[model samples]
Target chain A: MIKRLTYGLVALLLLAAGPLSHAQETHTLRLAQTWGPNTPILAETVQHMADMAETMSDGRLQIRIDPANKHKAPFGIFDLVRNGQYDMGHTASYYYKGSIPNAMFFTTVPFGMIAPEQYAWFYHGEGMELMRKVYEPFGLLSFPGGNTGNQMGGWFRKEINAVEDLDGLKMRIPGFAGEVMAELGVAVTNIPPGELYTSLERGTIDAVEWVGPALDFNMGFHQIANYYYSGWQEPGAEVQFLISQKSWEKLPPDLQEILRVAMRTAAYDMYIQSTHSSGEAWSRMKDDYPDVTHRTFPAEVIEALRAATDKRLKEVAEGDPLAQEIISSQRNYLKQVRQWTNISDKAYLDSVAGE
Target chain B: MIKRLTYGLVALLLLAAGPLSHAQETHTLRLAQTWGPNTPILAETVQHMADMAETMSDGRLQIRIDPANKHKAPFGIFDLVRNGQYDMGHTASYYYKGSIPNAMFFTTVPFGMIAPEQYAWFYHGEGMELMRKVYEPFGLLSFPGGNTGNQMGGWFRKEINAVEDLDGLKMRIPGFAGEVMAELGVAVTNIPPGELYTSLERGTIDAVEWVGPALDFNMGFHQIANYYYSGWQEPGAEVQFLISQKSWEKLPPDLQEILRVAMRTAAYDMYIQSTHSSGEAWSRMKDDYPDVTHRTFPAEVIEALRAATDKRLKEVAEGDPLAQEIISSQRNYLKQVRQWTNISDKAYLDSVAGE
Candidate 1:
């Protein structure tokens, strides 16, 4: 009788404890990115974001940032995060053109817009509405996580004296630049970021364009390339954080606010860090590789490349539904802004050049 | 005698550790920002950057992200970070017109090149170099960060059916946009971001144009305004991150590399986060405030706004040495690209609008 009564009491206690334990639930977010432990811009910002959440939330919400390889392959980051295998990820929209064609517009467009124009369209114009339509089916929500204020023209083994130099040049490039380059008779290739150095080192690729001096210097581009060209092909490549819909939906309003704050902070600080590091790297490269050639693209060549980029971007925007919405809104804004820039941006440049 | 000898040995060990403990490598970074926690974009990014250095280096490189108030105020973030009071910060170049009026070119120009064009000039053209020259005197480095893609025209108590609505109206604006609005006969007020909300809410301002639907929704502008319009004043407002020279010099080469990678990751991710959040926020906003009326600026108003923006930008760029350099390099590339975008961007947009 005593044993039976003890068992009954224990069962009751267990049932009572289950509700209490369930009520005090904790959440874990795993954010993935396609970079090594040392990549400064995105990786460092992510780590900082995770730490801030943990500290500010008082450990109630724990976020673990799984660097490029820890969780899965680098390219798989967006899919993994989107499919709910991971809670979140860091990526550039152009990286996944095959899966999400419309994403390219958000990441970048050839001759479409710069950082400010892109930000304005998405943040203020109808651009964001189109973004959700693209992401909704995939179960992801996106945000502006990083910006490489207009990028470099790229690194080249030979001087780009004319549009002819681009012909048959095997260049390591990404996103719309590759499409634009391909359209212009250049052999454009996508180099998963990690391999940019080895490929450049082995001459597997004759030319490449990465972020800028800051990223280029750290990646040791100066060690291999005899020349470091400007990155003009796709100015202002925007990067993003892809968060899982399931994870996003689960967060309380306050946690969501915290995430927004954390992401923005990461965005601002990372920009400074890159600019600082890139500038130093530039100085260091000059000091170390005194023979490294630095030259701007000829005016004619710049015009040709820009034309080709625009031509290719139009091909995609007109055909794709999501791209149509985003590109149209952005392009309208761009055209309107362009007329004014003819005076502001162009007139100023002319004045400076004359000086 | 034995106890005294043991005590002596322990005391000797303790005394020897004193200097080592007190002077433990001594690495601390000052990260400054022109924002408070309430302004999540850059402030949060700054916080993450600091946390990353600490975590990655295992506290060898300690970085503290200081809010604007911690220093003299928001406007001083650039100077303070430059002066080395703080190692790094996120700020808009236009905020401190007094310190380096030319720095405004680095942030943005009214009617300056679109996103891609602006980026091209800065990244590929000599824009970055010129910007560095301007900021270097102040001992700072600036990184391109969050861009408010085409900003919304603005929120007003009344709809902007014509340009006359702007006449004598007090508008909360800054940078090149404010100048353009002034030219358009609007009474423009340059209020720091912190004070914008109260100024607009209390009727100190007649109309206000901030980022867009995403940020605008959170800002609760719908409660006070009946009409929301398109982005006209600022096509793109590019923000930047600044770092101190002294703080950057102290890092080892390897840590420097990490910083670069971190910045790249952070900027890209922030861009994605902001864009995605804005989209979701815009869609969900109606559910929060059904009365939020979204209206496009009339064609005449847009044309006038564009004309005025262009005029003001030209005046500034033509007169300013740094602005001219940025405008020249930026527009040179943009001219080439804009031709192609004519068919590519504009044609597609025309088709979409027609459809």
Candidate 2:
């Protein structure tokens, strides 16, 4: 009789302990972000993700984020996560092109699809599968962190009416776009971002390509340049969220789903936030500086730029089968998706644009 | 000594039951959706939301969705949820305009913002606040469920060349756009969705306004109608998720967050899916039926439609203060955001449109 009572007591105890143990089982993740502490939009997105994860998990999941200043490796997020020093990372994929050349395709390509179209590619097309193929080898997982929408080509002091206008033009346009410009006979140079405003104002650089109006507003580029041209390069620049496979596997299934959904929602939210802020900033820029007119490159100049971009892409794809596969996938997907964009949003925008 | 032993036993029993009680706590909510069972992207979005909610909460919070076929109320989702017969609903807000006049603004206006732009307004600008004011009285909380990107205006047998082309034209267009068409001297009528194909094929209706290619492809419209006009009526038609205030209050904070984020992510996913499906469907349509051509209404006809839409909007906002506030907010937000759209995506699309 005593043995039976003891067995019953043990059964009750196990049942009682199950809920408390699960409820109290908290997992904390350390995240490293490329942006400095309290950076707008970018860092905000990371915090937003962490907040949702924590709240949705009811304190079961906690993410402790270390920004660039804290981590002291702004562009080294991929390495940090890969080496397991950080559980997660928020950084643009293109910044690590030197380490992994194929990483650039995940960020954005010159003459690529816009934000929604690119997102469709990522979620519904071969983007996620292709991304998984690239990152899986390194024991890392990469997801789209956020987008800056379509970037402006640059703020220029003079108009480019023809292809020749690009020749010998001293412009601070970095990355693949700069290479394209270099191929078009332009003097492409890179300058420290902190000095870009002064460089453009003092004519050290005749033109500068920064981000869209939201980030650019703080740079005060509109105050210096009168012509704000539309972009060809980085049509939808998507940053990435990198996570170590070991760290991801530590969490239970429920927490894993929570983290994934939180990151996805925060990424989409950041895109919308970028859209709102850009609109507000552009409106303020136009109001403050009426002379800052929106312009597009002439068809002749655009065609030359396109040719340069295609040539550069071909060279990048040479000899690397993975690079070639990614390039072809994006090219074909863009071709199919852009047709819908042209007939829908583009057609609607064109019909209602004059107002 | 006996009393002390009894007290110890009671305390131990309570401790044993604590975890089991909490672990067994589960809440189930019944949701009624406007779409029929297995309604492709629309129904898929609701199921996605439910699956996320269930997985993230470890089945603590469960949503049981009832499609229109089960509930027998395609347009009465709001009423069903409001009356507490259903704990949640997935339907367009505008479908209840007869009962709540201000609800239409939540879906889409005649020539308002597109998907991303509208999402920006809803999340960042005055949209959520205005929506709260409109919905608060109903004891309901509504969120954006999903979006059908920029909708196609309709399929037409003949190309619309001028304003005169619309005169006395019998078109099956519904809701606010139908009212606007009537103002343009078009004999606007409503037809059952099932009979739409035959009506158009038999020339009973000269034109028909359906959804974009994804949904339209199934209706067999493209095979019969060669002219697919870009949309003006519903730039971004967003469906809504409705919850009873009581149902929301019953959820724990964590489960509530799970539901909210799941709905949000699912909504954005649906938008992306629509984009992907539309691209696929439109491409197939073009390849299979080479005679089909994408067309935008002539500028004169577009101008006439715009005028009629504006006049109707003015009438709707004339006496109602809340309606006026919502209308003005949308207009101002659209004006501000569309400039960015024009200069960004529109300019980029135009620059890279042709092969």
Candidate 3:
């Protein structure tokens, strides 16, 4: 009887402490990213986020990431996460525009707000609420993953001095930007990333629009393209992180907050990293290819591109109430925010430009 | 005998789980901030950081914040944290320049890089290492707290069209910028924040250099001053978070990571919030105070200001080798990064300006 009583007492003590100690239960979440293995900034952001989460949770939360090469589905991350095939995914929202047409607004527009302004829209304006409305129905949660800053227009063999210069010009551009290009009488082509360099070099494509200098440095476009034009499209291209509701709900509150903060920090860090690497890469590009020059498309060309973009946006907003809501929210927010930008950073930059 | 065996088994089990379960221990840290109670963005950032730390640590780590009113030491946060009166502090690095002269560089400089470029320097370039060199000897570790974005020059009663206009002009400017103004034949005065509005209205000061529109909106300077000039000084004014080494060392690895990340996220969030609020406030200022006109100093004035700034920087870099290293690093890095900014975002903004 004494032995049994002692055993019962021990069990009761262990039970009393169990809830408090259960935080030690470890959870490992599987993540899939659209970028391939060892992709510089994008892949590094995923790793950074995972490291932060693990360290902050004392190894109780672990994230196992599979890049596009492992998953063999670069553009299918949306379905993968929504169906619970993976707990989380890092990919661009615009990639899913084929199935969800309104998704492109969240990634970027042809002539939208830049990174800081767009971030303000997301966090302090109507963006998060609209984003929630878009993702909640699918049992998925979406958050901004990273930004590429302001993307360059394209690497061109010749300067675009007029609207007529785009007439039948063979350019390898993609997404909504490509659609706007097509509207302007350009021969917009989709080339594989592997073939882009050869295509531009062999004159199969007269211009190629990759990301800005950091990623573009690897593509070797500067070696062949003498003129790099400033961009009107994809002002701030924000990639996204999507999580399955089931997986998110399974984590305890502390771990959930850890994941949220880790992802947010990683997103901001990627933008800063992009800024750093782009600076370094641009400097190297100029040193190695002294003949390369920077140009902005002429007023005529910019005007045409802007008009085409506005027309496409109008069409996109047609026949869909939620799409119209998202579009108008961003447009109104940009109008107010851009005025501030013009008065502050833009004015300051212009004033000190001669220096 | 049975009872003894049972007790031994329970003891072994508890011993095995001791390290894992020890995470249940809780710690509370006291933080002192430079802002008074209910201060808008600055105080909110402190609260946001503390909330995140608590949530992420599941109450294992709690941060109790004491604003300036509670502590009665607005500019003495560095000393407070250094003496262990407070475990942490949130204040501008430059506020302690009287005691730590080299500390001002970590905040910002006249005609320095903007927010994104400055952030690149801090995270990717030599900023963090140089910062460590500055703060390590003081037994405190510092991190970027928040940014006010690109600060405006000031609210001016009259427009400044040329360098001659600065002659004998009385301005309520502070810090190194004031030194630069004094070099340009301007009368620089420091007034209490509460007295600033009445002084400016009564022509005690011809210009009042407060922060940008967001913080400045509350001061009602727009009602008195007609011209709001773009900034030449403190382009990206970043405040800092300081923690005593003893307090930092006492926390476990997980809680430390939690604190670091919480601070980082809150810092970035504050910048975005500033952007949002500034845009909102600028719009309202224009609507309510239609006489408030935005202006940029002419080329002559800007050139003179830049020259004065460069001269001051050289003097500061004279005897201090560490200051020289930091100043040179920032100049060289800014040269490279600003070139990237010019070619990418600036060029794009200029191209689309007519729209």
Candidate 4:
């Protein structure tokens, strides 16, 4: 009889301890990223975020990442995460504009705010709410994953002094920028990444618009193109992390907060990393290829490009109310914020330019 | 006899569970910050960091913050943390230049790199190692706490049209910038924060240099001074977080990572917050005081100021080898990095200014 009583007590004790041990139970999340394996800034940001989340949660939260090669779907991350095929995805929101028209503004716009300005809009202005409105219906939550700072326009084989210079210009540009270029009489072509160098090397493409110097140096465009133009299309292109609502609701509050902060830090870190790498890469490019020249679009060309971009934006905001709302919010916020940038960083840089 | 055997088993079970429960033990760190209680941006950064650490660590790591009012040591945070009176401190490194001359470089310098560039220097360049070397002797670890972005020059009662316009100008500028202004024949004065408005109003000082619009607007300087000039000195002033070596070593790896990431995220968040607030504040200032104008020092004045700044830097670098290495590194890095900045952000901004 005493043995039976002791066994009952042991069972009760184990029950009491069950919840305590359960608190330390591990949860692993599967993540799919659009970038290929070992991609420099973009892939590293995902890994950095995962590492932070894992360490902060004391092994209770693990993130398993599958690059594009593993998933075999570079641009299909939106559908994958939204449908719960993956718990989370790292990709650019603009890539899915065809499927979800309202998604493009979250990435960037032509002649838009820079990195800091866009970050301010997201956090302090109406950007986060607008983003939530767009993604909420799909049962997904989106956060800025990383930034690529100011992108370069392209590596042009010849100078572009006038708007007429773009007439029949064969260029490897993509997305909304390509549409804008097509309006200016440029034959915008989409070439695979592997074929871009040869396309520019041969007479197949007159110009190629990759990322900035950090990603562009590897493309070897500087060796072939003399005019490396400053960017107008994507001033501060920010990629995003999309999480399924189901996966998010399953995590404890503390783990959720951990994931949120890790992603935020990783995004900012990527911007800084891009800045550092771009500086190093640009310096090397200049040293190795002295003929590579930095150019800004002439006033005439910039004006025409801006007009074309405005026209496309107007067309985008035509019927969709949510799209109109996001576009208006960004435009209004940019106007207010750019005034401050103009007086501060812009003014300071101009004053010290002679140095 | 059976009861005694059961009691022995219970004791063993409890012993086995002891380590598991201890792994969840909580640690609370005390932090002292230079800012007063409820100080915007600066104080908020400390609270943000603490909140992140606490949430990420699942209540296992807590940070107790004491502002300057509680600690009664606005300028003594470095010593407080170094001596273990406080486990951590939030303060600008330049505050302790008198005690640690090398510390000033970590904060910022005249004609130094901007925020992104400075961040790159810290993360990718030799900054972190050099910073470690400086603080290692004191048994303290330092990290970038926050940035004020590009600080505004000052609010001037009269415009500076020429290099000679600075002669005998009474200005309430502090720190290294004050020294540079003194070299330019400006009558530099340090007035209490409360007395600054009246002094500038009464012509006791011809100009007053505070932070940018976010912090400066509250001082009511715009009501008195007409010209709000862009900053030349302290271009990207970064405050710091200092931790005692003993306190850092005591934390578990998970908790340490949590603390490190929290500090980093808080730093970047502060920059974004500043950008948001500055835009808002500048807009309000302009609306409330339309006569307030934005100006840049003329090219000649900028040239002269840069010369004075360079001369002072040369003097500082002469006696100390480490200082020379740091100054030289910053100069060389700035030369290489600014080229990239000029071509990317600067060019893009200028191109789109008309829009």
Candidate 2: where are CA atoms >4 Å away?
A1-11, B1-10
lDDT of 1 by residue, B1-355 (tens): 5456556544554554443344235477666677776665556556655555555433556767667566757777776766556677777887877766687776665445544444445655576788888888877777776555446667887777788878999988666677778877999887876776777789898888787665776677777887766564444566777777666777655355345434543554444445544545555665666787667666676567667766766776676776776667655655544432332223223222211
Q: What is the C-alpha RMSD of each candidate to the true structure, in Å?
A: 14.1, 1.5, 1.2, 1.3
| Candidate 1 lDDT score at position B280 | 50
Winner on lDDT between 1 and 4 is 4
The C-alpha local distance difference test score for the whole of candidate 3 amounts to: 0.93
Better of 1 and 3 by DockQ: 3
lDDT of 2 by residue, B63-124 (tens): 99999888898999988988989999999999999999999999999899999999999999
What are the per-residue Cα lDDT tens digits for candidate 3 across B1-355? 7768777767766775565467778899999999987999999999999999999999989999998999999999999999989999999999988998899999999999899999999999999999999999999999999999999999999989888899999999999999999999999999999999999999999999999999999999999999999898988999999999999999999999999999999999999999999999999999998998999999889899999999999998889999999999999999999988888778877877777
Rate residue A241 of model 4 by lDDT. Answer: 95
Judged by DockQ cut-offs, the docking class of candidate 4 is medium
Task: Give the candidates in order of TM-score, highest first.
Answer: 3, 4, 2, 1
What C-alpha lDDT does candidate 1 achieve relative to the native structure?
A: 0.64
Query: Could you say which candidate leads in DockQ?
Result: 2
TM-score of 1: 0.51
- Among incorrect, acceptable, medium and high, the docking class of model 2 is medium
| Tens digit of per-residue lDDT, candidate 1, span A110-220 | 555655446656655666677788788888888877665556667787677788878898888766777778876789887877898889788788888777776777777
Candidate 3 structure quality by residue, lDDT tens digits, A1-355: 7768677866766775676468788989999999998999999999999999999999989999999989899999999998888999999999999988878899989889999999999999999899999889999999999999999999999888888989999999999999999999999999999999999999999999999999999999999999988888989999999999999999999999999999999999999999999999999999999999889888888889989998998998889999999999999999999888888888888988887
Deviation (Å) of B232 in candidate 4: 0.6
